[model samples]
Target: MATSSRSASTPGWPVSGAQSRPPAAQGAGGWTWALTAPLLVFLAIAFLGPVLLMLARAVSDAELPSAWPQTAQLLRDWDGNGPPDDRLAAALGTEILAARRAGTLNRVANRLNYDLVGSRSLVYATGDALERGASVRGFADLARIDRRWINPAVWTAMRHAAGPRTSFYLLASVDRRLDGDGRIVQVEREQAVFVDILLRTFLISAVVALLCALLGYPVAYLLATLPSRWANPLLILVLLPFWTSALVRTTAWVVLLQTHGVLNEALIGMGLIETPLALIYNRLGVYIAMTHVLLPFLVLPLYGVMKGISAAEMRAATSLGAGPLTVFLRIYLPQTLPGLLAGMIIVFTLALGYYITPALVGGGADQMVSGSIAFYTNQSLNWGMAAALSLLLLVPLTLMLFAGRYLTKSVPV
Candidate 1:
């Protein structure tokens, strides 16, 4: 009665205790976000911002526009029905001279080279002619400077690359290209490498995951089943890899697996073989080094999940006339599925992006997509192709990540 001034029935008054609690809850949530704002901002800037910029480069065609704006605009306006007109030709020559003088001609040349072989030479030669005051009054004069100028293929390459945005890099990543007729087609057999590399990436990841699973399960089981007095030291050993640098670990493998290294020496001393095994710098070496590097990743999660499993269920199943194998297969294994899948996914995802391990231990045939990304980034200086390859690598890894999460959640406990 004393509190009747604000009753439940009163409009704009709280209906229940739950409703009255909302302001404090909202205040708490606001404080939560306030506390986390710095971390969120850090992730956005440090992680998301660079990733987005890289992905944008996959579709970006800014080089031509940046270095040869007049020519890019003229090319955009020209219909691809025939060769560019004298006006476009003159504009190209003039801009080529300007770009060459400005030291940005390589930008335009490299972009066109992505589509047409020897286009860099074409662009450089033409720019050199124009810089020396060779007249380019018409398409014919421009064509005289380089016969490629008369070829529709070169014009088509220029037309495709004269964009603010393009799918050229993305298509090329998957071993496809846009032809002069603008039709999507497979790249030449010699150039059709990325798809195979992608497949090899998946194959290597799957095999490594499988190997980790096969090898890790027993180790994790031992860690889980052993008494704490005995398990602590083993657990420490399992976690030991985390304390070491991956570079050091991979180097250790290189030391061990090299032809004249410890393992081969030991094997030869035992009269196990007449020659040193081809253990390093091959797919076998890749598998060995990667599995060793990644084994701990698979074991730790599995050990945690395995420890949570109750012995009572196994006892009950055994008392119900179930054999040891049956109890394990029908009871123990299913419970471990979530962690098993989770750990394998983590291993596989990490393997897909592996660079240093393969680079140090694997041969040319064993190189993964990350190698191509590095080659483009460092060697070829093709940022668009690098970003495109990174994008392609991300797509499947993202899908596998989601699938792993779903399977981990959906698997029956």
Candidate 2:
């Protein structure tokens, strides 16, 4: 009984051996590994594996010019300043004839067409003539089939196509490309669209995150400070959005905000305005829709943090002669900042990749980075450019996430 009393009173002591449990790592090593393997495999197969593949595809060219040993060697030696010489052209013709006869002309054309616009039809036209036993003594027949065959730009594109991998897409994503002299140079100002779109993406996402912060702060404070019984109903209302489909919610907003929609009719009926407001299908619509959807992200985090703050601390500050503004700025705001930062980073990163909402609500000029990514991947069928754009957005988002995580840990609240 003395030993039992001592064991019961002793700090960190097990009452009895029968009541003991080993440290999980020490006792369940095999079980831990066995249970964790499926998750690791799932992550590898679904996320990490696809990310690595996208990274590789961003730099890889679909063309396999080297597969034609003689043609590749001939073109590699030719200066891309002007059109190829008759000998190199003859080699290209022979290879095209062989490729056409082997029923791979379409693949070859599709690859080259990515580099040069009319190359697909040019290949098909020339291959058709060659298959029909048309004479090709020089570049004359090839040029007649397609005027691009004699163009310097076509030679430049074809010269670069002689490799399995190239940085053409990555360079182009930044509005730079190789010149005839094989030097990296900026594309013309008229051709520089991605850079402006990228900047606009950052601007729009930042604005959306700021809007969420400003709006979510008040809602979260109310939820945290109110009596739990009172707040529960409002909290249910706030969470009602999640129960509905995101697409359905966005579509409803579109119907409500359109020119002849419910909002305008109500305003006009109430003598609020004579003219209908331009709200849907523009930057305004994007901001409103995204803010509504993502506001919960900011609110939930801020509410969690605010609930942890003691009312006694604020009362103590008041008793010590601090004004409401002073106590809030110094005490309350500082405590909630970690959660604010977390919520902003989450909303901003999500906004950077926003596609469906913007696509459905925003006009052409208001689309975000993911819109361009979808355009390139689905519409243009340019995987390299799409992957490059995706990487461009992901790198900065990852940096912000890590920096915010470090800040969150450092903040006391």
Candidate 3:
């Protein structure tokens, strides 16, 4: 008998068939982290780095504090109710001359303008006098460039702007600002724009999410109940648009809904109307395009939940004297609640930040929070306001993302 010796730790299996043991535990554990290290570094550099920079910029102090240190020291001690004193003007003039020689006056001017609308011109005029070798001895000589420098509002704005940090951008997001004394206060009624835009963003997103739910639920049910051979093709159709370019799809809607485009032309030729409908470049267009684009997001979640439900559950419920409605409401709907919530949250959050579709298909009046963020960043060059608005949009999405996971875990499979 050819018998093989076995170690005491070995299981009672054929010796030749035993699996080979690893030579090192360290390679399996440490090498796994080594493989993922590059991805972690890449994510830190590409995503987290920019987000941190944006947040830092959002709370950054006004440039006046650094650009004119002497003026800042003076402003720190002076009573804001007092006049634009000669010492304050002399310090600003000296700073402006120094800044012009250093070629960084424009940045200071831009910062000043953020505090007072016409302060940019004031800074520039002072800078130009200094650059042209005009001798400015004191506040009286500096006021020659602009009489507004002696004005109380200009001094008040300058005094308030001497900051190491500020909450101005964050406050402005909700239609608030600092008063002359640096106290937080509500903005004028006409200037109260973003709160309305924020509300409109929520309203539009809610409507689009509801539309997706209403239209997608039945289609998802049909897909789940159908045979796989039929359901596969239907599922492909649902996913087809999602695979296509979002820009292209939004553009297609513009063409179809435009006054003289395919849909309007076809309707006119069919004698359906005398004039083309006002569909494109309005809230109607925004809603229709957003709902279509988000419909698949809702469908996929519901379909996954529906497919998991056993047919035996329904039969058992019916045998227990449950009607069709009763079986669905009592027996099936409970199982699908997690999916329903997941779909709604996904659709709503996505719609909240939708920029391209709304910009392409919607009028200015129909634009959302994302549009305002873009306008502030690109057109107005207000990075702080843009970053704060982005925070507003991001916070809600983060909350919903966690809430979806918690709710999904709570539901019975």
Query: Scored by CA lDDT, what does every candidate get?
Result: 0.92, 0.84, 0.85
The TM-scores, one per candidate, come to 0.93, 0.87, 0.86
> Residues 327-354, candidate 2, lDDT per residue (tens digit)?
9998899999998998998899888988
- Candidate number with the higher TM-score (2 or 3): 2
Error of 2 at 150 (Å): 3.2
Model 1, total clashes: 0
Return the candidate ranking by lDDT, descending: 1, 3, 2
Candidate 3 lDDT over 31-123, as tens digits, reads 999999999999999999999888766677657777788888798788887575787777878888898788877777887677668989888
Candidate 2: where is the Cα deviation over 4 Å?
Answer: 1-33, 66-87, 101-103, 135-147
RMSD of each: 3.8, 4.5, 5.1
Worst 10 residues of 3 by lDDT: 14-23
Candidate 2 weakest lDDT stretch, 10 residues: 61-70
What ordering of candidates by TM-score runs from best to worst? 1, 2, 3
Candidate 1 residues 1-413, lDDT tens each? Answer: 75785664567756567667767785897899899999999999999999899889999899999888888998889889987788998888888898999999998888888899899999899888888889887899987898978788898888888888899999999999988899999999999999999999999999999999999999999999999999999999988998999999999999998999999999999999889999999999999999999999999999999999999999999999999999999999999999999999989999998989999999989999999999999998999999999999998889989988998999998
